[model samples]
Structure formats: C-alpha cells, structure tokens
Target chain A: MKKLFFLIGMTFFFSSCEKEGVLTKGSNPIPTINNTAVLKYSGTFVPTSGITVQGNVNIYAQGNKYQLQIENITITDGPDLKVYLSKSDTPSSFVNLGNFKGNGTSVYDIPAQVDVSEYPYVLIHCQQYNHLFAIAELISKQSN
Target chain B: MKNKLKKALLFSTLFILGYTANAQGCSDAGFCSVGNTFKDAQSEIKNSIEIGGVYGVGEEDVTVFSPYAIYTRIFTNRFAMSAKLTATTANGSFGTISNLGDVFVTGNYKFNTGDYDKSKWSGILGVKIPLTASNDKINNFSLPMPYQSSLGTFDVITGLDLAIKKWEFSTAVQIPLNQNKNSYLSQLAPTDKFDSTNLLERKSDVLFRATYKIKTENQKFIFRPNVLFIYHLGKDSFENVFGQRQTIQNSEGLTINGNLITSYRLSEKNYIEASIATPFVVREVRPDGLTRAFTIGLSYKRNF
Candidate 1:
C-alpha cells in the first residue's frame, strides 16, 4: 500500500502541469451588443453612499434578443457584488444579470423568459451581505 | 432533599447513557468512517485494503465522480491505524476540473466496558490534509466552491464508536484548523479593486449514525440498515465574487439519509461490500455551482 501511494504521488508530481482542465488566469472579453441595435430605454445611475457609482444603462433591442449595455460605469470596488435588473434593489424581485465583472462597459443578454419591459431598475447589489450599492431607474427616451 | 437531588441526577445519567448505547454508526462517511467496527478479524488480519468509487449528481447539471483507496492495519488488539486517499473529477456548467482530494490518517483505540453486555468502545483521532488548493479557477473566474477538489483547509476529526450485540452507534465531529488563504474572489473581475487577502473560512460538521446488523442463516453474508443525520454548522466565510468578506448564506442545514449496506464474504480473507445512500431530507441552501442529492459506492476489501 505504501509503495502504491508513493507511485501515485510521484506520478501526480511529475504530471501536475500536464493535467487537463487546470485553472488558468485566461482572459474573457466583455460581451458587446451589435451597432445595429436600437435603443429602447436609457437611464442615469443614482449613487448610494460609500461608493461613487455612476453609469448609463441602455436597453437595446436587436431582433429577438435584448441587450443591457452598461456604459461609462464607475463604482468603488466592492465584494460579492452583482448586477441585476429588477423592480427594486432587493434580490427577491431581481433578475440576476451576473457577478459584477469590473467597473467598465459590459453587456449582458436578457434571457428570453425575462420581461425586461416590466423591470425598470438596474441595481448593483452585494449578494453576500445583501447590501444595495447603487441603483439606476430606466426611463423612456422616446418623445411621448 | 439532598438525597432526592442526587437520585434524580443519577437516574438522568443512566437514561441518557442507555439511549446513546442504542444508536450506532451511519453511512455519511464523515461519521461512519471513524465509528465503524470491522468485526473481530482485528486479531487475525494485520491489514485490510479497500478500493471504491462514489458518484453524486445535483442541480445545475453538476456532477462529481470520486475514486478512493483506503488502507487499515491493526497493530494490536487495542490499537489500529488507517489512511485514505481520493481523487475527484467535477464537471458542470462551470466547466471541468480534476485533481487529488483530501488525504486522511486516523488512529483508533478500542477498550471494553466490564458490564453484562460486555460492550466495546473506540476512540478515534484523525487529520485531513489538503491535496489540492481550494482557490482553483477556470478562465479567470474562481471556480465555484464545489468545483474545487479540496476545501483548502486542514481539519481535525475526533469521534467515538460503540458496539453492543448486533447494534452499532457512532458520532463524530470535524473542524477546520486553519483558514484557506488562497480562496480567490472569483465573483470580482480581475480589474475590480478589492482587498488583497482572499481567505475562505469553513464551518464544522457533526454526524450521528446508528445501524442494526442481520446475519444470514449460514453467517456468510450480512445486511446492515442504517440511518444517519448530519448537521452543517454553516459559519462558512469567504471573499465573495465581489471581493467582500462575508458568510455564505443557506449553508447551514440538516440532512437525513437512509443506507442499505451489504457485505458478502468470498472467503475468510476477502469480502465484497456495496452501499447505497439516499438523502431523505435537505434543509439548507447550497451554493449556486454545487449540488448533492444522492451518493452510491461499491468497494472490495481484502485482509492480509
């Protein structure tokens, strides 16, 4: 048994780098929406205390897919933060976009099952502590 | 008044001891591993080896396949030593990663109580060494907690096992001895500004199990049905994907499981054992990337 363990240890030690699916710090480019997309609604971010958060949220429609583009975003870095489209800053009513990638321009696809038309707010929330960091309420840009 | 109080206390202690003696080990592996009685072959066989595989499937299309080996040696009638090693491969929506898992070494001491039942008790002490760093990542996103092969912490485990007649009862506790500093905050993008220290804190776990064994008429086979209850005292803390240190919610929960354990003796020196366990209740919230619903395993044991 000791000999078998020793053999296994030597094998792993020699082949550590050769192991498949090892974690790497590879880069994943931020997703982008097409230029042909039409802007449906837009909003300016409302900052909350503790972080200077400012950004423009543009909801664009291209065929059947809707893209939520966050532009010129600046927020003090936070832990466990996430982006969401919701009726309020609370998570129960929110549709999770994903974890905050960083303070920058990024686009996320709206799932087909989600009705972005009804959820008018974009919220930055700390999922670990359930703290709302910032919120942006979308308003119609069209001249009614 | 003093005599009455003494009598009350004595009665309570007796009742509690009687209750505990009726409960035995379970299949959770956490408790059952330390609390098991491998029978009276301890004097005849110097060593026993076990090889097995476990598979688990859960929500979000996550799956885990683990193959493991165990070696145990009885140094004397009252003393034994055991070690286990495992490798795990996990795959799901988060991607795939495979690596060596935790390694454990344990020492046990067996003694007898001078009573009518002549019951036996075993005390166990062990340690789990991390074989893989818990902060493993995929494409720069720290792989969710479940994808990591090791919990990234050394754990101290201790427990007690009791055997009387055809019943066995066991309980054990596993506590992390150190914080894993390599837990990278994957939720935060690399560009995100956050604290430099990314540590993951794990909670302690407790298990209680009881089993009743029924032997065949010829005594060549044995069937043991067991029930296990596990509690995760969920105070797990880690830097979130957003780079904030906080406790992961829905982590604390209780699970109840039923297991059917069967062993068939091929000879005096060899046996085949199979066990299937299904969780009847899950009461806590698990992380987004990992889920555990059922576990199954089979192993061959050989004594030398």
Candidate 2:
C-alpha cells in the first residue's frame, strides 16, 4: 500500500507539469509596414451592451492603401461578430471589415475606395443579433 | 443594503427547510469518512439511497442548481458499490442556461485496523461519465464554457477516507483521461464539422477535507462541522479551431471553505441533512462566467 501510494503521488506530480505544445505560436504577429502614415485617426472602444469591450483602434493611411489596427482590445465573446467602419454609431450604412476576431492586437486591410474620413467610427457589431457591442469614434491624429 | 437583507432572508428560509443530508458539499463526495463504516459481520443496513440538491452562486453573476440521487449497496461488511446521477442547471446573468451535467459511479473497499468494532480506513475509486448533451446556444453561436453543463471529458476519481471517533479526514484526486473535442464555438462557420479540433482540456484536482460530528445524548440530532480545501492542480486548456491550445489563465486555483452540517434522525431508517459553506480562501484566476462564492445543500437518506 505504501508503494502504491508513492507511485500514485509521483504520477500526479509529473502529470501536473505535463504541458502540451501549442500548434500555432506567434501566428498573428503584427507585420512591418514600410509606408509612412499620411493620415491617421485613433480611438478607444466603448461598450454598448452585453459584455465589456475595451480596445484601441488606429486607422492609418499608407499611400493608397489603408490599415485598421486593433490593439490591446478584449471583447465580450459573441457570435457572428464583425468589424465595421460605420457612417454613424448605428449599424446602418457601414462598410463591413469582415469578421471581428476575439480580443487581442490584430490588423485588417481597409479598402481604398471607402473614405476613412467619412466613416469615423469603428464598430464591433454582432451580425447575428444586429446589435452593436462597442463603438470607437476615430479622431484625427495626424494628416500628411 | 437591500440586496444584503434579501440575501439574509433567503438563507434563513433555506436553512430552516433543510434538515437531512449526505456528504455532498461544494465539491463532489462531500463526506470524508475514512473508517466510519466498518462492521464486524454482515449488518442489517446493507443498502441506502440519498436524494439531495445544491445551490451555488459564483462570480460573474452565475447561478447553479444541482439535484442528485445516489444509491449505495454493501456486498459484504467491507465492500460497497455506489452510483450517483446529477442534473445541473447553470444560468449566467448574460442570458445563458445549461442543463444535465455529468453522471458518475463509485466503488469503495473498507479496511479496519485493531478490531472491526473500531474505526477503519478505506479507499474509493470512481469514474465520471460525460454523457450529458450540450446544445446550448446564444445568438446563433454555441454558448461559451460558463453556460455549458459538462466539460465533455471522462474523468477518474480516487480518494482515501478515514473516520475515527468524532473526527473524519479524507483526500481525493480527480483527473481527466482525455481531451474532449467541443462543438461549441463562438464564431463557428456553418461548414465547420463538430469534430473540429476545438477541444477543452481539464486539469486534475486534489481535495482535502476534515469534519467533526457532535451528537446529543439521545443521538436524535447530529451537528457536524467541516472544512474543505480544494486545489486545482491542472491548467484548463482550450484548443481553438486552428488547433492551437491556450491555457485558460483563470480556471486553476485554490479554494478553502468551512461549513456547518446538521442532520435530524426522524427514525432509525430515515434521516435528513443540510450544509452551508462559504469560501475563506480563494487563489486563482476564476474562469470567465463561472463564479464561486457560497453554497447551500440539503438531502434526505433512507437505509434498509
């Protein structure tokens, strides 16, 4: 019985330290952008309903292309969530920036045809429920 | 101030209604009887059944209700078999509810030292079956871990129990045997298969408990006070749709609790028990949604 107890204790000690290898490590590292920012707008996310959503969104114009960068943001987990550059705070008249990933620092491509200056709000909208969880009003940071 | 008064009134009402109980507390296997059930020969009390319910309010405004039925039968004076079925309903203030938790079975072997008339030691082995179906959804997306009933993993439970005089002490370990591929995802695609690499891995847990029971001269009313310490030794891991595993930083921690248990013996064959526990020590990042605060439970048992 003593030996069996010792064996069981040892097994628990070792198994507790067993850590599995993560399949995707550093897979979403921020890419280096060579183009300098010609026009920039920055804002922080504000939660509307449900879980708390907090993050900073930076809209940078690099020559003809634009980038929508979300940094240090934690969003309330939701379904069919999408990121949008909206004309106003509401979900109407918004340019869909595709799916909104979970809270973290990530970047998305912004279409050049869409006027970033006109649509000054970054909205984390739940597409399934047609609800706006959070909104970030972009303010002019710099314009070259 | 109003909420506190309401809470006090609710607790008092529940306490008065609860009279009988088994050892089911916050964690599983509430009683820590190491050597309390030893018999010299085949006794008349060979079979017993207990029915109980537990209510818990955790962090993140989560409420849990668990109702269980347990049956135990002694084959001889030293061997016993027990089976338990538990139904759980978890509700998140964020509007998520899950029902039907896991069902488990346990087998125990008792051993006594000195004489059969004295207290003895025993070992318990058990397995939990996660046959509960989890289909809870919110806004067309599968509910997160907090609103789901089961971890969807098969777990093994092993423990030791000792009862001597007025004191009872026991320790137990529960470990998951495999990672369960969870179908619940926040933003899963329609084409995504249920067998996707999205998995939930649970960590092993160690529980230590001690209880002292004081009975009246006639033994009609029993008062048992106990303390429980539970350590989550394993890290809860989550595998995303991309098959990348991330350790949920908040799911592993230590909890220390103390509770007063009371029982009333209505007759020789029937009894009632109840317990209320509050956590005095908590060290860990609590998993999102599921919060742990106080627990109340009541049970009725009959022996034949």
Candidate 3:
C-alpha cells in the first residue's frame, strides 16, 4: 500500500510539472501603402532609461481613415507589451492599438472616433507591469 | 409525524414567500456542492460512491463539460467525511482544453437534535485543492479562467444546513487563501472577449439555498426544487503590467438561480438523479469566469 501511494504521489508531481506555454519573438511585414496614402505625422522611437528601442513611427491618412505604421523597429521583448496612442507619454489617457509585435514593421488601424491630433504621443508599454518601454512624440507633417 | 409534515409545509410556504419578496442573485465556484449539503437526505448506509457530470454553456458561448466522482464514509451517525474529484473540458473559439480540476475534502457533523424527525442540523467544513496551476494557455497565450479547469487557489469552505421534514435550508461561504498565478492579458488576445486574469485575486463568496422535496406514494421517486442565492463579498483584484494590484470593478454582486432535481431509486442501494439549473439574475461583471447560462447534469449513486 505504501509503495502504491508513493507511486501515485510521484505521478501527480510529475504531471503537475508539465511545461507552460511561452510567447516567442516574431516579425510582421508593413502593410502596402499607395500614393493616395499621405503621411500625416511621423516620429522616431526613444527608449526609456536603460531600455533599447530603435524605430520610426508614421501615421498615414487615406481619405478620412487613418493607420499607424512602425518601420525598422527593434525593441526589448517584454510580457504583455502593447502599442498605445497616448495624450501624454504615460498611458493614463490613451487608446490601445494592440499587442506590440516584436521587431516589427506592423500597421494598426485607428478607430474613427479617436482624434489622432489630440493623441500626440505613441508609446510601447507593458500593460501588465505598467512599465514604459519607448515613447515617440508625433510631429504633424502639415505643421512641419 | 403528521405535525412535523404540517410544520415543514408551513415553513416552506413562508420561506418561499419571503425569498420571492426579498431575493437577490449570485453564482457558485464549487463550494455549494461540497460534502452532503445537497446529497440524498440522511441515508442509513455507512458508505457510498457517486459519479456525475454536468454540461453547460459558459461565458462567451464556451461549451463546458465536467465529470466528477465522490466517495463518502460515515464514521458514526453524527460524523461523516467525503472526498470529490472533478475533471473539466472547455471548448470555445480559443480552442479545446481539458485537465483535472479541483479536489474537495469535506467533514460534516450532524448536531444532536433530540427529536431528529422534527428538525436536524449539520455543519460542514471543507478545503478545495487545485490540481493544476491556473496558467493553461493556447498558442502561447494564456487562456482565461473559463478555459482553465481549476481556479488554482486553496479555498476554505464552511456551511450549515437545517432540515425539517421535507424542507432543507443551508448557507455556506468560501474564502480563497491565495491568488492564482494565471497571467492572461486581454490585450494579447485582442479578438477574444475575455478580461485580464493575470494573477487574479478572487473575493470570498456566501451562498444560501432553500430546497423543498416531494416524493411519490411508493417513495421510489423524489423531486426537489431549490432556490439558490450567492453573493460575492467584494470586488476581485488582478495584478497589472506594472506589478500593481487593481480592482476589477463590478466583480461583486448577487446571482439567483432556480434548480430542479429528480431522483429515482433503482433498488434499495442504487439510485439515479438528474438536475437542471438556470440563472435568473447575474452580476454585471464576472472576471473570474464562473458564469454559466444553464447547466444540466446526471448522476448515479450506490450505497453500501
């Protein structure tokens, strides 16, 4: 009986130690942009203290609809990271673009209700830990 | 016996009237079914085994099926113990996942009421043990609580039940001892309609149930209709990306459900039961993902 109990205990222990799922780094290609797509604003990513980030962010307007694009970007991989269009560098008042795909040239559609002009800064943040990884202050192409 | 039956009927009518007049709502995370709280009323057998399963549609139209087994041993007329194990399978847009759920070990003590036929009271204490860490994931993304088999917290459960003839009334509470290590972030699964469950901290819950039983002339068949109320003690909390705890608003509220169970005795020691339950009221937010639109179950019991 003791041996049988020990065997059952060991089996349970090993089963409980099964591997958990882990996220891996990947890349996505930038969306196609035609001549009709005009640049509205652009900025370069600036890393937070002790972090590494290199990227250029651009907002384009095709008619009234808008899209945000990140090009040639390299960022520190983190858990639950997201891209945000924020009123300030902090994520207090912001619209979540979605999860930040690693080292990506990726595109995100801006909601029609969101006034991009009011959201002057773009951020890469860890939503779970509330850590800011990178910030980019948009400069309007028309203003420049 | 005639007087006892009349008193039970009167009490049952009064209780139903009061319940309907001042009723709220709530949900269950497993404590309500522990021990002998809802088992076949006091049997003369010293030992028994039960096997059962439930099928239900949960949050976001996820189909959930759970199969369980329970073993009970009566040490004396006053004391008994039960152990239950359950396994769950959930299928939804995210995918299919199945695993061993939680184990509940409960001890029940029937109080000495000199007149056992008039009224009997029992107290129950139990502990829920999780079989898996609540971090099951699909495609490297953590699945929400609805998809995971276990809530992944050690919980203490305690309750009291009073039975008078054909009516039974019970109240119970379940308290979590620790937070689960689930790291589900809604942002990662933008298309899914689930809330963030990262390191979810569930609040305590209290529940009350009133059941009335009816039996056939031969006593071969029994039917019970129950009204259940559960209240989440407070808002649940979850750890954010910044490693700070944030309250999940609207997580605490009441849910009310109506349940009907029918049982048939195949022999002196063998029985079968079928049950159906539906929620009449639900909380605004249920981040812990225990919501069920409806549940239907069947079980077999054998007494020795």
Candidate 4:
C-alpha cells in the first residue's frame, strides 16, 4: 500500500500540471471571467449624434502623454450631464478624461484622449445615450 | 468654483476616452479561438467565402462570376479534411464555355515539428466532384460536353502547408482521375467515324499555390495574401474540332492567379473572412486567348 501511494503521488506530479494556468485541463476545465458584457449600437451619422459616446475607437496615439486632442462639443439642445466610472471594468486599472467640447453651445460633442495608458476603465453611464454614438481609438500610424 | 469645473471636465474626458478604447471584450456573444487548430480552421472557413476566381475574365473581358464554398473539420493537431463547392456562370459574349459547378471533399493531415515557439508542416488530400453541369451555348440551344462535367470526373487534390512563426508557406496540386468522356467527338461525326475512346487524355492538371501572412492579436487574427500557379498537365487524349492533329498548347498551358485575405474570429463558434482574387486566365487549354477566363466567389461559416 505504501509503494502504491508513492507511485500515485509521482503520477500526479508530472502529467499536464505544468500548463495549468494557460491551457485548459480536464474534460473542459476552461478559465472563467465574471465581468464581461455585450455592447451594440447603430446610428446613421447625424453629426456624431451630438453626444458622441464611443468605445472600441481605433485612433493613433502614444502613451498617456495626451498627444492628440478632439473637441466635439456642439452644445445644441440637450440637458446638462456628468461622467463617472464603474469599478467592474477589467483589463484596464483606471480610466482618464481627455477634455470637454462646446463650452457653451446648442449641443455637446466632448473630445477624449487617444492614449490607452491613462483611460483604462471603459465604463461610462450617461443620462444621454442617443447623442453619443462612436468611440475613437488611436491606431498605430507607422503604416498607411 | 474652480475645483468643480476641473473635476467635471476631468470626468467627462475619461468617460469619452475609455469608451473609444473599448476592445472586443470577452463578454460578447461571439467567440474567437486562440489555439493553432482553431486559428487554422478559422482561416479555412473564412477562405471558403472569398469572391475571386482565376478563370473569370475571358481573353478580352470578364465573362462570368465564379463562386465557391469550402468546409473543413479539424480532428487533431495535425489532421483534417475539407469540402469545397463552387459554381461559375457563363461569359456568352466571348466563347462557348457555359455554367460550371463542382463539389469536392478531401482530408488533410499535418505534422508539428515546432514546439510552443516553433514551426509546423501540414498536408491535405481531397477529391473534387464536379456537381455543376458543363454546357456550351450555341444560339438558343445548349450543347452539353461529351463527358460528364462535375463529380463524375472525380479530381484528387493534395497540398502541403508550412509555417514558421507568423510566416506561413503552402503548396497544393490536383489531378483528375475519372473515366474519359467522348460524346463531343460523336457529335462531330455522323456515326461510323466517331471514336468514343479517343476523346480526353489531357484532363489531369497540377496547381501550385503560395501565401504570405501577417499575424496579429497575438496570432488570433491573420492577413494572408496568396498566389496560385496552375498547369494542366499531359495532353488532350483526343483531337481538335477540325479532327486534325494539333497541339492545343495555348489551351493546355500554365495559369497564374492571386488573392488577399482578411480573417477574424468573433467567438469560438463564429468567425468571418473576406478575400479578392485578381483577374486570372482560366482554360489555358483554349487555342486562343479569346477562350481564357477568370473566377471569383465567397462563403460564411459557423462551427457546429
């Protein structure tokens, strides 16, 4: 019984234990994530819809140095609003604000920073969801 | 008042930037596989829907639109089989070649020599069953080719795929292996002079293809543009329309083609691919460039 116990211990030591965290094990011992959600929006391009909320925006940018800036504030006819962060967003530790547009206009098309280092948290709730449509992301500018 | 304004602007800026930088988060309904097997299968399915054909343009202009679908099932790290179905329309203004269609099923086996950071080699085998009929239009009448066109003339295809890091290399060949058809000769003759046995000898062909790929998203997405060179081997076992001894070298020469493909994974079960092939000469077997043609097509897929 002692010999069998020792052999069993060795068996478990060498198997597929090395690739534990990376590759999935068992019949389907896959990794699980808790805070992921689906997002979908459609617009016909009505001048950034006035609000201009964007996610998955692919633009060209550098570190958190604030290399580029866009001000889309067309203060048209909308209510006064405020922006806040939610903690559930993963992948990014924290989010940063670039700047506001249309200091005093009929509509508001706020411009945000293109750097990913600072704007990590991607959750933004708005009392105004219809006006904001697209999110701009800074892509690499090396190639055309 | 100063602090309130700064904070308000700060929050607004973060909110906008954060939303714009949103990646295809894991929470979406679709799934994109990260492993090698999944990536390969993803490329194949996406490839099936591409809309470009080599033999589409006639000697002077594009005659028809060519479309095809490919399906592949991966069984192991190095083994899989694929089925391709295709259809090509007729270019009437040019010559006589009419609508063409085919259905092919083949198996593939790959060998992995590289490890977590190495290269691998893959081989593929498949048979073509020409499901589409072969017809040549004469005025209002449809004149069928003497031999059955599609599956009846089973064509076997084979190829090898090699990959080192993000760069991949592959080559494939196809050979027809079915009985020869001789009805066309019979049509030319009244009866006694028609020899059914002496119809088609040069049906066998060999196609060579190569590809260059740019892998991204840690190899999850790949952009591989490829080129194909095809040569119809041997010679027509039969004779020319004039019943004279003539070498149809022009019709039986080699062909060249190319395509650029973009493939992405939405989720494990869902993936999308797109591609375009430039104008290529089809039916080099024709005596004149007037008979040359090209093809293009695309497909969509969901893993069950």
Give residue B116's lDDT in candidate 3 (0 to 100). 36
Model 1: per-residue Cα lDDT over B19-125, one tens digit each: 23332222225334565535646358889887776666544455666667778888887788888877667776556767777788888888764343778788888
lDDT values, one for every candidate: 0.68, 0.64, 0.77, 0.38
The ten-residue window of minimal lDDT in model 3 chain B covers B20-29
Best by TM-score: 3
DockQ of each: 0.07, 0.02, 0.08, 0.00
What does DockQ come to for candidate 1? 0.07
CAPRI class assigned to model 1: incorrect
Ordered list by DockQ, greatest first: 3, 1, 2, 4
In terms of lDDT, model 2 sits at 0.64
Candidate 3 interface CA RMSD, Å? 7.3
lDDT, residue B136, candidate 4: 24
* Candidate 2, residue A6: lDDT: 54
Model 2: residues >4 Å from true position, as ranges? A1-144, B1-42, B96-98, B113-119, B133-135, B182-198, B288-291
Best-performing candidate as measured by DockQ: 3
User: For model 1, how does the per-residue alpha-carbon lDDT over A1-144 read when each residue is reduced to its tens digit?
Assistant: 576556556634432321224233333455688989989889988877777888888998888788898898999877666678887655557666665667779887777767777888988886545688888889876653
What's model 3's lDDT at B72? 83
Better DockQ candidate (2, 4): 2
Residues A1-144, candidate 2: write the lDDT tens digits. 345335434432332111111211233243444467654888999999566977899887777888888889998887667788888988777766656756788676776677778888988886545678899999998754
Candidate 2 local Cα displacement, residue B253, angstroms = 3.7
Encode model 3's per-residue lDDT on B1-304: one tens digit a residue: 9999999999966754554443323224367564353356455788887777787778875777777777789888788888887777777766677778899998999885536368888899999999866877654456788888888899999999988888889899999998886877675453448888888999998888898889999989999898888898999998654445789999998888888889999998888999877677878888887777777788888787
Q: Per-residue CA lDDT of candidate 2, range B1-304, in tens?
A: 9999999999886653442121212434322222223321237888877777777764444566666666678887778888776655655533545355566777888775445246768888888887542434433335445455565668888888877777778788878887753434433432222222235666777888888879889978888788878787856776543335767675677777777888888788788888777667665654332334667788877777
